[model samples]
Target: MMITSRNTAKAALFLILTFFSAASLWLLLEAEFLAITLILIYVGAVMVLFMFVIKMLDTDQSTLRAQFTRYLPLGIFVSIIVIAQIVLVLNAGQFDIAMTGIPEKHDASYSNITAIAEQLYTLYVYPFELAAILLLIAIIAAITLVHRNESRSKKQNISEQINVQAKDRMRIVSIKPKSAKESK
Candidate 1:
């Protein structure tokens, strides 16, 4: 539905539905933490961002419709290739329980979060740190882009403001008083 929807808002709504379905699947797999994270992060935060961006864009549907036919053939071709690949993989017997033994059940006291943290910190520490650094860089880039056009904006210099003197702000102008007859 997301891919087929002509309206951007409807597409976003479909995407949110897809996210909810994925969260439900995660719940079925007994990964409650992952399910909650998926909903909160993707549906709550990311989808809100997407909706805001889509609204801000105010796209013209006519232009989009005009281009749809141009890409239709390629879209169908790629989709067919993907579906064929999925079918081939499913029939390969790689996912058979006889080939890959059933996973061992953990004890009642076992914490998935703890196990995940252990693997992330120990085995995937470098990649995790790299991802964090990339996110930090992306945040910095976004801030820079937002402030790029604010050259005329007023920005207070805290040090200069703190060091400002009363003398600089006030000018003592002295005017001589003249008699009424002399002024006339």
Candidate 2:
């Protein structure tokens, strides 16, 4: 929905809501940490950033309409393929992979959070760090892009404004007070 949406603001809003829904699903699956992280990172930070960027940037809507028509046939084909794949997956219900041994059931003492944290920090540390790095890069790129289009001189200088004297703002000229006698 976000990808195909015509309005950028709406798309950003949709993306934020989608992330929240996915987070809710994760919470339902007992993945509390992942859910919270998704909310904080994507909803709290990234989505807001995307909205700000979209609002700041100027868009040409006419170009979009032209492109939409050009891509309609290909888009419809891809959409049908995607829908078919989703239906097939739903009809299958579950994967057919056979477990080599019976899986261990969680006991009353087992901590889901602890287990997740252990695997995430120890086993998946590199991938986790890489993702953080990627996010950092994206932020830097956004800042650079916005900054590139703005002139430094246009930025306000508080010190310069405060230090400016009356002389700099106006000139007090003593033009002999309009002589009424000279005005015939």
Candidate 3:
């Protein structure tokens, strides 16, 4: 029992450390775009999502039962198939394994940011703009929808809004001058 618990803790720690290490490796690869995306989208967002789900389900490593009877064989089979496929693909590919620091032209001349912008604006302008518009519309719709409640008065009348006038908020004040009283 003690050994199993220790193993569980070790496994959990290993999983967490591996997740962080993988992200760090991505950062070291000089692929800033991919690394930041992995950290921001995967590590930050998905980790939080998983934590929420774990809390919601009241599941911890200790309490969870490992039901390997039904799924173990299937999992092993699938994993082996995936590994074999990956191995075959990697080994069969004619990818250039040359460790030449960077392509001669690119290392000295390629301005990645400028090139990316040019490609994005010239090649993917319409789609990028459309996506931006869609995101904007979604954000506006979400903000509009999130505030909807009967607690707020029912639907507003556009006519009532349009009909509003200065008189509605006006106040009349008399400008009377003070008269001096005569002493008898």
Candidate 4:
């Protein structure tokens, strides 16, 4: 019933290997942004969260493979199917994606990130702006949900809040000296 450091180290190693595999896939797909995000978000945030939860639970053992006994045969079957599909895909040759390495010549128009950005804003502007709006909403919602009011401040009703004007908070009463000076 005790957790061992060896199991923890193994888990850490497995997570790192998974992250690297995913990052390698992103690179193969020519998606630089996705590869970087995978490393940053998965390796950085999710792995850190995993370690924190594990440490908090003081786990000496994991129930990952042991708890899912009923699904093991199905899992193996599905994994075999997936591996077969991947093999088929790798062996199929439909797309001509290679450049035959012949001497090439072209106008020098593809020099910098600016050119790519300009094309993206013009050609893919709608999706780009939509993504920005989505990200903005996500950020705002995250901020709103995270900052809960845990303080024990007195709660006021809506009518009370609306009725309380500036006069309730402050008052400027006429002084007795001003009245006496007027009489004199």
Return the top candidate by lDDT: 1
Compared with the true structure, all predictions reach lDDT values of 0.91, 0.86, 0.67, 0.72
Better of 1 and 3 by lDDT: 1
Residues 32-151 of candidate 4 have per-residue lDDT tens digits of 566777899988888888877767775544555466688989989999999999888867764335633433443456333465578789999999999999999999999877666746
Total clashes, candidate 3?
A: 0
Higher-TM-score candidate of 3 and 4: 3
RMSD from true fold, candidate 4: 10.9
Clashes of 2: 0
TM-scores of all models? 0.70, 0.57, 0.48, 0.46
Q: Distance from true position, residue 175, model 1, in Å? A: 15
In model 3, the clashing pairs are none
For candidate 2, lDDT tens digit of each residue in 44-145? 998889988998988789987888889999989999999999889967846544524434565567777799889989999999999999999999999988
Deviation from native of the Cα of residue 148 in model 4, angstroms: 9.3
User: Candidate 4: misplaced stretches above 4 Å?
Assistant: 1-50, 57-62, 94-112, 136-184
Report the Cα RMSD per candidate. 4.3, 5.5, 10.8, 10.9
Clashes of each: 0, 0, 0, 1
Lowest lDDT 10-residue stretch of candidate 1: 102-111
What is the per-residue lDDT of model 1 for residues 72-180, given as tens digits with 9 covering 90 to 100? 9999999999999999999999989999896666667877678778999999999999999999999999999889988887889999989999998999989888989
Query: How much does candidate 4 score in TM-score?
Result: 0.46
Q: Which consecutive 10 residues in model 4 have the weakest lDDT in total? A: 99-108
Weakest 10 consecutive residues, lDDT, candidate 3? 1-10
Please name the candidate that would achieve the greatest TM-score relative to the true structure: 1
Sorted by TM-score, highest first, which candidate order results? 1, 2, 3, 4
